[model samples]
Target: MPRPDRPTRPSARSGVAPFHVMEVLAAAKARQRARGDALLLCTGQPATPAPRRVRAAAAAAAAEEVLGYTEAAGDPALRAAIAAWHRGRYGTAVTAGQVVVTTGVSGALILVFLAALDPGDEVVLARPGYPAYRNTLAALGAEVVELDCGPDTRHQLTAEMLAALPRPPRAVIVTSPDNPTGTIIDEAELARIARWCAAHGTLLVSDEIYHGIDYGRRCASALESSAAAVVAGGFSKYFSMTGWRLGWLILPEELVGPVTRLAANLTVCPPAVSQAAAAQALHPESLAELDGHVRRYRDNRDLLLEGLAAAGIDRVAPADGAFYLWADVSDYTDDSLVWCAELLDRTGVALAPGVDFDAVHGGGRVRLCYAGAPGDLAEACRRLSRVTGRA
Candidate 1:
């Protein structure tokens, strides 16, 4: 068998970093299959099922319509629904012509990278961001320039940092309710960053996947800052429709056609059933159901924070939103990967190592998902206390 690192026909793209959370999740699942007691706190997947209206919509589409491919830009009605949804949520003037449906946020990122960047171009993002940003850009031969964003800046990019870069990158990506930290950018600060990018002629790519899951203050969209911003969103996180693989990008007038063209060749069109279901996902009934899931996630987040503190893990990131608790576990072990492996072996509680998010400081950190059931989170806390020898 050919090894991953020594494959016979490996291209440079094959060398992109793997998503460690998914790797850990696969391990956790295997352990559950064998031992039947794994506590999964890795990966940001909601335990809630899709809303009844969305499911009904998908079933109805399957029964009534041909499952054939829609237009490459997605169904016109779905695009209109997404535009209306964005307009209502963020008070932005979005039109259906600006929307292009994608296979997922992952696909949106790839398409954006392909459309906006050339080989050897640079993309700037905050450190400890979603790993896919780095890996995806790297796979496309784009140089990823990471801004070291510690807790002092709420783990978000700042305008000063962008100004200090040796030269402007081709694009700058920002995420609110950020991955690995769950810290949202201040609206004013985000606007400043957007202005800086616009002045510097850098394309602003905003990952708004975690929107609608905020705790207290709702996160701001990049569109509020710049008209040229490229916004990527999906039904995966907030809508609890992970397997649906429905995501979209809101583009400027110039890039819409190019991205749509790229998307046409990429996957032809997103799933017909998923598009039908996602249309209903934006309905009032579905939004209400999703809000209930957010409430449960909020409660679970509170429980996890208290439990971590009680277990002497007090140096956690300030998770203002999202269902993740990025904890500093340096007191327990230096290498988070090894620590996570031991934790799974001893306690059957799986978590994503910090290294997946940050290559330099990640060895001392881990990301725990609080998107599971409340009972499971409580049990995870108990198992963590036992494993860490908390009194």
Candidate 2:
């Protein structure tokens, strides 16, 4: 018999992790209210609203007939459109049957993990990688084996790094145009990793959510090299559709049934209206609007790099893609949590602590998102300079 006064116990998986950035932001918000001045550069969200087309699509969807659930996998027309988009963008031949629509890329990740791994199975993930990968894996009862890839490797996971792991993992998660670090794994490296995963029977979960946001080089798809890969993507980043909460997964034919079954049990299907808008996002005109957003991100990335360097905070990884700049702040402070807190308190400029991305060296670094307006970024840089005493 349990004591009436006792607190309910939480499961181990529930104790997995917290995204430290959220805490920092909360604290920063409090401090901002107290001081009444601050600029936020810490968030990974774009400051821009969803593109005109996306909004139009959503409005069109809302007005259009009864909003009801579509297929578990997704609306067939949307899947076909997504397949076609991939073909036009990457020159990769994909089919509608290979696509699995989910609530978001986050949902896609959970589905992929469920479809690929058993309880206690280990999956290799890059350290200083996206926090969700580790947290999601733990929640699903899978062991997350974190591989440390530092700035030397552009904070990317490579075939050599994978080979050095003590044992081959049950699956591996690779994010190109990765979060925090914003590095893109080249085609050769992607191919090598895909081949290695195939040879070792390791499922490859390739996160291509940042595909269209690259600066110059073409983004590589794991599906181009191996059939054992699960490609996760969404309209959040490139299409400026974060609030829409629409994303997708392209899985191998054999795993489609299991993924669909899991999706049916978990979400039943993504939101009907969002799915309808997502279908519009797949249109050529909508894609053109998305590409324009990507170009803006690229410009923001350039501005941030130049501004940070000019401010004497020059130690930053090359942000080939994605809208984040992972900077080494070891010279100023080893404890990034403290630094970030102090910086936020002092300047009202929010920044993500390295701890959110890397458990190892995260203490000495910080990640700044450049997804805001150019003027905001410039102003944030100025505030950062003053806050860091580098102005």
> Which of the numbered candidates is closest to the native, going by highest TM-score?
1
Question: For model 1, what is the alpha-carbon lDDT of residue 121?
Answer: 94
- Candidate with best lDDT: 1
Residues 212-317, model 1: lDDT tens digits: 9999976999999899899999989999999999899999999998998998898899998999778888889889999999998899999999988888888988
Show where candidate 2 strays beyond 4 Å.
1-7, 31-36
Q: Model 2 over residues 177-260: C-alpha lDDT tens digits?
A: 989898888789999999999998888999999888888876788988987788999988887888878899998899999999
CA lDDT of each prediction against the hidden true structure: 0.90, 0.86
TM-scores of all candidate predictions against the true structure: 0.97, 0.96
The per-residue C-alpha lDDT of model 2 at residue 94 equals 89
